[model samples]
Target: MVVMGSGGHTTEMLRITKHLNKERYTPRVYIVSSTDTTTISRVLAGEDSSGTYTICKIPRSREVKQSYLTSIFTTALSTVSSFPVVLWHRPQLVLCNGPGVCIPICAVVFLAKALFLIDARIVFVESLCRVKSFSLTGKILMFFADKILVQWPDLCKVSKRADYIGRL
Candidate 1:
């Protein structure tokens, strides 16, 4: 499973997918924000749509510049709604970067893991832009993500949970 945010996040995901051996990762599931209009085209254009992937959308937990306090309610609601989606996909692994939508999906995956509904792993890669510090989503996921990969050595120092993977 691949979860993407808009713009740069989507671009990075598409770039990462180019290296995937589709034979090993069949029927890929991509999670994107419902409000994002551009990512779909980018996926269709850049990815091989040879019937090997599925795209799913969930509500965006918080918009850019959305108040942190109000985001609490929105994130909770999105997490609830994401349960069914996550259950349906039942991804063995969820790969995501910093994005509000990824939070709800990853949360559902964690909850499913706790409840023994399914065994899913989360691989979170901090964006290259986050050289000095983690984004809000990255900070929140640092504890829950099975693997926290950082593109820089500095970030690894900031969070022991993060491994310096060097620009991935």
Candidate 2:
């Protein structure tokens, strides 16, 4: 499963999807925010928009400038809503960048993994903008995600688990 955020996050994921070998990643599942207006169109124009892909929508965990306290509730709501989608797909791997929606999806994946219901590995690709430090989502997911990929080598110093995979 691929979790995408708005604008740049979506663009970056789509770019990666384009280069992926379709045969190896057959019948992909794409998770997107219901509030996002552009992601669908962008995915339609993307190379991986073949009949094998399925797009799923979940509510955004937090909106821009929303209070962190309020986000807790919304994030919980998103996690609840994500259970059905995640279970139905039961994807073997989840690729997420720095999207707020990613938190719930990855959480569900982790929870299911803990319960031994499914085995899904998560890979978080830290956004290029986060050079020296990690984003809030990146920091939170550092311990949970199987691996975190960073663009800059210097960023690796911030976390021993993070790998500098160069610019994506």
Candidate 3:
């Protein structure tokens, strides 16, 4: 199973999984922001639940806040609160689009001994958190990520396991 953030990234993540041999991949959705509109729950309740479940009610920030401290605090708090949910899901791999929803879920994956796989397109700094926090965050993900797929080759500079795949 895999966890991803919202919007185009989520769409791409879903598309990639669909091509995986169903005998191997079982896709599920986990919504990570409070305000970001997503259909993970509906998808889970309706068609997607064949081997899937919904993880709802996550706190997502709307815009980059004026106060960095406040933004960090809220994001961190939301992430910390979400640890248990990730444990319950017990996914084998997590594919993050970027920081929007993946941050918190990655933290939980860290604590749960699950693998973390990040998409390659988000090689820019904006895709991640602060540099000070990067080391620890990267440590958690890097130590466990089975693979890091990149849609862009430039991402290889920052990625731990860079694989060149077409953009999702």
1-168 per-residue lDDT for model 3 (tens digits): 344556655566556555656545444545546665564643343344365445556676324443655667776877876676665655655655444556566666665553343221222121222222333334445554555555655555666565556455
Tell me the TM-score of model 2.
Answer: 0.97
Q: How are the candidates ranked when ordered by lDDT, highest leading?
A: 2, 1, 3
* Ranking of candidates on TM-score, top first: 2, 1, 3
Q: Which pairs clash (backbone N, Cα, C closer than 3 Å) in model 3?
A: 33-58, 33-60, 34-58, 34-59, 34-60, 120-150
Query: What is candidate 3's local distance difference test score?
Result: 0.52
- lDDT minimum window of 10 residues, candidate 3: 120-129
Better of 1 and 3 by TM-score: 1
Residues 39-139 of candidate 1 have per-residue lDDT tens digits of 98888886674888888888889988999999999888889889988899899989998888999998889989999998989999899899999998899
How far out, in Å, is residue 14 in model 2?
1.4
Best by lDDT: 2
Which of 2 and 3 is the better model by lDDT? 2
Evaluated at residue 79, the lDDT of candidate 3 is 80
Candidates' C-alpha lDDT: 0.88, 0.91, 0.52
Tens-digit per-residue lDDT, 1-168, candidate 2: 999899889878887778888889877888989899999888877744359988899999999999999999999999999999999999899999999999999999999999999998999999988999999999999867999999999999999999998987
lDDT value, residue 158 of candidate 1: 93
Better of 1 and 2 by lDDT: 2
